[model samples]
Target: MSNCKKISLSQILLLVLDIILILGVITTVIVYYNTFFKGSGNLNGLNKFIMFALLTVGITCIFFIILELRKIVLTLIKGNPFVWLNVKALKRISLECFIIASCYIVNFIVNFGENKYKFIYLDSKGIHTDTEPIIFILAGVFIAILANVFKTAIEYKEENDFTI
Candidate 1:
């Protein structure tokens, strides 16, 4: 095999992901502070508590997905992209995505049929029809499929290793 010491696209993506994760955390903090601590809102104590819980869950899932991607990137940089560890990481990332999506769905359910903004934006017209959670759900399924593909690749690699 050719020497794999050079930087690759995966490395660049990893750097970008790291930056995004850092920025996301900072933004989450700032938004939470401004929304709750600023004391200029109509949300009650229970609503604020539920929203915070959901946000925490969603952020935790995102953090885990980023961490798994970092592990996968490191393995790819080492020229061992077909390792079982990567398969596990992909599976974990998929699960985290699904969890984040579920959290959004629950948020929607909690805010359903309410005319006032509670847990989620509730306008006189209708509930907040945010499709972000649906997108994340689809992304999770796609990642799960990708994980299966990686698992197959790992099997092929192991078989090739055993061959002459």
Candidate 2:
């Protein structure tokens, strides 16, 4: 317990951003389910099942992300080691990045086909095409890296504190 009472403004900003990201995730899930799955007469049974599965997974991920964010916030409040908090957060963020990137790749492949074969398959009847998964992927990756950096910084700080 070093007498370090100074809180970095950047950490405050990161906490705020994490809160916003959690809210955005929730909104995205709601919009996705409502727009894609509600009263859609186009999809057959199998397709409907697949869509529901995807939605369920997406919602579950959002819940996990929120949980990780909460853990990080708790760590900050308790003034615990950042590395411990970041390990959990970074793992979630990395998984989210991979999931979002894979989803985009799958969507692209399913819709357009491989090797320039112009096969235009609709994702669903009423689903909006405006949500680009690439953005999510990139954001997830960025946050993951940020978390790792925080972890590293804390490790360095601990080392310096011990050297004195």
Candidate 3:
């Protein structure tokens, strides 16, 4: 569509992402406060280590994802969405997703014996599941494949430019 429309859509998306990232940071700070300052020694060393690691990696990935999305949106605003740099950004975002997914799996395995899997919640009220990491893994693979498609498209566009 028009440049204005493209920027408007991306700007909306960027706003939403910014809000989510802010909320995530706030939640993470609250969690850390409750887990350490007010934990009353309920959490062990290993659990604390894992929690910190998970949050660090998760937040880092989120930051990188937002950066990559900003790059893509900027390209869209410039009327050039299929560029080599966008491909690299997409690839990096995909790798970040995989890394986050692996962290979740590691956390699950580390807590398997303690019956306290962070990804799978089991409470007296009911059984709640957090399969977000798995979904992210799948999304990562899909995005990686999409990046390849973008690479091919870029190559084709270059060839067309040369022909013209």
Instruction: Give the TM-score comparing model 1 with the true structure, all chains together.
Output: 0.83
Q: Candidates 1 and 3: which is better by lDDT?
A: 1
Query: What local lDDT score does residue 138 receive in model 1, on the 0 to 100 scale?
Result: 92
lDDT of 2 by residue, 45-149 (tens): 766666555656766676676667667766666667476666768778678766756665664555464443322345558434434566677778788788788
What root-mean-square deviation over C-alphas does model 2 reach? 7.6
Segments of candidate 1 deviating more than 4 angstroms: 1-7, 115-129
lDDT tens readout by residue for model 1, 13-99: 899989989998899889788877886387677888888889889988988888899999999888788889998998998899899
Candidate 1 lDDT (Cα, 0 to 1): 0.85
Error of 3 at 29 (Å): 2.1
**Cα lDDT listed for each candidate:** 0.85, 0.67, 0.84
lDDT of 3 by residue, 1-164 (tens): 55653337877877877787788789878877886778737567778788778878977897889878888888886789999999999999999999889888877887778866555676898988879778989989999999999999999999999999
- Ranked by TM-score from best down, the candidates are 1, 3, 2
After the best TM-score superposition of candidate 1, give how far the Cα of residue 31 lies from its true spot, in angstroms: 1.6
- Ranking of all candidate structures by their lDDT, best first: 1, 3, 2
lDDT score of residue 121 within candidate 1: 74
Candidate with the greatest lDDT versus the true structure:
1
